[model samples]
Target chain A: MQTEEEFKDFILNGHLHYIPNVSIDCAIFGYHEQTLKLMLIRHRNMSSWSLPGGHIKRSETLVEAASRNVRMHTGLDNLFLQQFKTFGDPNRIQFNKFDKEKWFEITGLTSWEGNWLMDHTISVGFYAVTDFSETVLQTDISIAECAWFDIGSLPPLEFDHSEMVKEALHTMRLHLYHYPIGLNMLPEKFTLSEIHALYETLLGKKLDVSNFPKKLIALGLLNKLTEKRSIGAHRSPHLYSFDREKYTLALKEGLVLS
Target chain B: MQTEEEFKDFILNGHLHYIPNVSIDCAIFGYHEQTLKLMLIRHRNMSSWSLPGGHIKRSETLVEAASRNVRMHTGLDNLFLQQFKTFGDPNRIQFNKFDKEKWFEITGLTSWEGNWLMDHTISVGFYAVTDFSETVLQTDISIAECAWFDIGSLPPLEFDHSEMVKEALHTMRLHLYHYPIGLNMLPEKFTLSEIHALYETLLGKKLDVSNFPKKLIALGLLNKLTEKRSIGAHRSPHLYSFDREKYTLALKEGLVLS
Candidate 1:
């Protein structure tokens, strides 16, 4: 670990004694196995599971800080990122007298020993959903390992992360029915069933195949590609991709997720 | 305006107490004259115009605080209230210097002053739209009169109210484009032209008459009221109100203004 002296004269000086004490955490979700899963890391210092998050930097906007943190920890830059909620409640943070020794080691070198870091923290939350098969991530050193936990079965998280995950999943599922996700997460050309599967995974329910395509087609937010997937031998479903210009404009005016 | 003795023990004991410091402000809007209008109150102590807003009470929830503030100021209640945005720029409060002398007269009591009073003021914003014809309101004593200003021809507002109005209008415009606002704003039954006119005004544009009904029908968030309008002789138009249940459900799921 770097000495406190090495970090003191840097930007930490700008923060100096004035760290706002707030952090941003993202419930980065990836879809696979017909289930929604969240990205989490095993903290090397603490030997506990935690959501991928970091403190807000002095020079960054909150949204920018959130986006940058997601990219920095997970190596998933240019991914779907959106601030969903902000959690603020007193008495949320607690470290008993016994836990302080280990807690300080986990937080890294610190100046004061008898007190916790900062006064109170308010965390801004962001959520993103993507198909896991497409991503190649670079895990940061603080993260012992990065893995996805199924929405139904999350491990015990260090803070209010489990609640954050649940809220994010619920938010994502709620959006899946009304809004199309192909604009950011889906590949250029994907099959009808693949999109349907993604939707089913998000909604956690089966969908009627007949009217779904007709409804999507009528919106004119999708463009059918002439090509079809070669891997699936039973039937070649028409490939489709989001119409960027129209999708963006639809998003701007008011698009119901239904 | 209570005395210092009434201060809570926790509040008085701390040098840097973290009060939520949030206030609720409503951008109450009404429709009239084939144009969108906003209900604004003249600043109590100054010639400046501002949205009717107030500090939230300690015992109330945010929504309750907003609703109460609207009713207290405009004397209009039982309306659809929506929180469109939360402004927390760390610099928003420092924008306008408090009119101390004027406030002293308006409240007729002095307890808080200096840093404590300044720190006591952070705000959350809400906006509502209603048809002005159906409601009666009595203005609060602080304002000379409540006036509806055309969205375009608004006077300069005090303390970031202009931006608040802009945000609220944007939210309302998004709602008019997507969700059905029948029972919520319009009467139980209304002509297609009335609905169309409302949308046209909020959207700040014109709509193709023939095509508008089809789009509304396609959304299925609205109901066709069978009642016919007997007032004007312009080809008896149908009367309808908003479908509250579907609209509420749609909104909860991810209804966004594009």
Candidate 2:
């Protein structure tokens, strides 16, 4: 935990050194238990949730700022990130008088932070894929909690975060149809059914289970491992891992997973 | 042309009402004579060229500002446009000391306009496809000329405009492979070879000419017209137009042109 003085210094002046009016928001998605989930943080003072995001430093690229935000929230780095869109609706930062007063009361931040938050901000939206179980959640000083929610059911989000999430899902679906993406979301040596489940959740529809493995194998992107795992009262299923060389080639060649 | 005072007013106080620090740049692509081209404007006082772009209005979306910029240069409205990326390097608006002095000399823009121009500007990039022969060139007062240069060869561009163009072309190619394009770049009725040329130029590679038409026809996107286009010493090729209904369906269903 940071001291009050340190927190004030970080929030009030830390961002002052960075580029003003430009920010980055990340939709860091993880897949587990046959469901798609997004990481969100609840503000310490407010009940609404928001995606992990921060201002871009003067020396870094927009994408670098997004990566930094991901690390700050999840304690993970080098995730597979892609820039999907830039949201610059001028009214995005507008707040009603009541809302402004409520924010001041909750945050105990006077004019400086209030004006900084209300600036007409332009945010670049990026989406990242990572293994759900691998990340260590780290809530920032201003966040009450950090958690992952099923994309199908999310809490009321702050600002235009809901719109940003919708756009990220749209971009992910488009990419899934044309690219090999499950590798980033799954653990090593996973069964064929696991990979299929990941795709089904991402596409929001069921794919032919029997044909899914065939299509993926045809792309020559997976290596069937010698080891197998047995379920109770059932025969063993073989484990599989991505053949990095072939997977890289398939990404460039454009694999049609659907 | 407006007087110098009006020009300065338009550049300075005219845009001051809009949101600060955010701008829009467009790569207006057109197809003509079996070549893909991009619209560029030469600054009145500089040798370097740049895309037709403008600052976002306080009331408009980023895309809306891009459309306005396209119309300002081409004298055409409602062109098919797609937002590709946003360029937000902090050093983007930074000009060398010599260039700054030179700009003040040439444009007679003192502190206000100069500061506005040098403000750390973040620009959203959009690409629009239009028929080359249909546009009327309209050069703004600050522009020496507005013209189209073949995508294969372009002049020296200003700031990070060259990087923006490269990104736009990359996005266009990626979109071309997964979507039904070229409708905006071609005339209402066009020969199969003409459409093929457009795709080949955009993709930067020659596709099998015989197989290209078969793929497009297979998608049911082309409506066979009763007319034919003539070529000397060869049989006239049949003309075709996009079947709007089927084309819209294919767009949703994902047409893989590759």
Candidate 3:
């Protein structure tokens, strides 16, 4: 190991040093009011919005950083997060034609001179679908506003973020067919329509309501209840809840839903 | 656009290092005559062996880096490399701490201190299942020796790569029930016994040969020619080639083999 003094000297004089560019961005997804919602943070100064994200520290592992970033952004405790993919394109950021001096001057909160604004960035994209009802997000000024965006109508995003969103949504769709996901999006008990609406939001289309509920219930991921839909004008749909015990057991047993 | 001057100054002052510590190590697999092969390399001047890997460049993506490194080490081209996971345990190098310094020294590489080196290091893991019969691998001194190790009998590996092997194998096993992936390890087309043997090597047990041929022919991933097995006192197993047309179409249409 280089001595601390050597490290400081090395930092001060090294020519064209390399830094691993790693940031943790979460695709915090949830189902709300019959729509699949994704958590987004609007910028304070820049005319852009983003998935909650930040850099990983020297001591933090990738997963740790992701969980921490998500919790800090969403105020959700003990939330489990998994890294889905890492985007590393030499040209991924050509859009950031930020003249360094000017961009730094413009975003005055940062000191570019001392910050070794490394360019070789590899972003690890993580995903977690949780329930909207339990999330108590602590909003930050760095994040001027926070809200959930319906998956069907995502606004244009800055950077390659739009592509990242597309990729995450694609992965979620695949997972839905093969795995018992989106459990965190619903309540302790929900109707078939709620689940179908959630699926529609994610898929950006409607589903055959007649076939979906039977297929899902047959998957054994959901537990049926004696309760009927508590509030509805049409014929009440049956109430159901995720069978966490069986689902968790099946997942641990390596059941690939597909 | 970050100016060349700003990029240079960022490198010189340690305020913006560009080299990435994240590397990609591939656990390439191939199936041969009743055997499974794992591609491995011996580091120059080191008795220990490692998976084919290299530094992720600023302009480079993980897929590019892993494929390039594998090609460089083995003179192999167009191998199917898949990005599966990233390994970043804070202290994964407790026993092999000196290996990193020694490898860099031998390679005559410079550091991108501070933001690059001191900040963090994250490595992504990729996997490739190739048809060894088609790849023409070139070996060099950068890697003193290269060989395909049998999965059942692998020597100890350097760093945390052994764990990476386990994960890759798990992924491969997960694919077996769905599609015939080990075909990538075989020649253009050979006999039914050859295919069965390859599975035995992976499964680590003997299998009944009588029913194997019928099952493979039913998968429609193979085409049987009038050729017969030439070895032993038995009829030659029919030579077959991978149905590339079906494989490509299946993958494109997301028609999972299972």
Candidate that scores best on DockQ: 2
Off by over 4 Å in 2: A1-15, A97-99, A102-114, A208-220, A224-239, A245-258, B1-3, B10-15, B105-114, B208-220, B225-238, B245-258
Worst 10 residues of 1 chain A by lDDT: A10-19
| lDDT per residue as tens, model 1, A149-237 | 78778778876777787767765654454456655455678777777777777777787773454566778877898887776569677
Q: Under CAPRI classification, how is model 1 graded?
A: incorrect
Model 2: DockQ against the native? 0.51
* Docking quality category of candidate 3 according to DockQ thresholds: acceptable
Model 2 chain B lDDT-worst window of ten:
B97-106
Q: What are the per-residue Cα lDDT tens digits for candidate 2 across B1-258?
A: 246666566555654556666778899998876777899988666667888787777778888888888988888887768888888876875455224454555457665443655566788899998888888988867678899888878998888999999989877777776677767777889888888888887778878874566678887888899998888668898999998887777665555565
Q: Which ten residues in a row have the lowest lDDT in candidate 3 chain B?
A: B8-17
Best by lDDT: 2
Clashes of each: 15, 0, 20
lDDT of model 1 at residue B91? Answer: 53
Order the candidate numbers by TM-score, best to worst.
Answer: 2, 3, 1
Would you list the rank order by lDDT, best first?
A: 2, 3, 1
| Candidate with the larger lDDT of 1 and 3 | 3
| TM-score for chain B of each model, two decimals | 0.76, 0.85, 0.73
| Candidates 1 and 2, the one with greater TM-score | 2
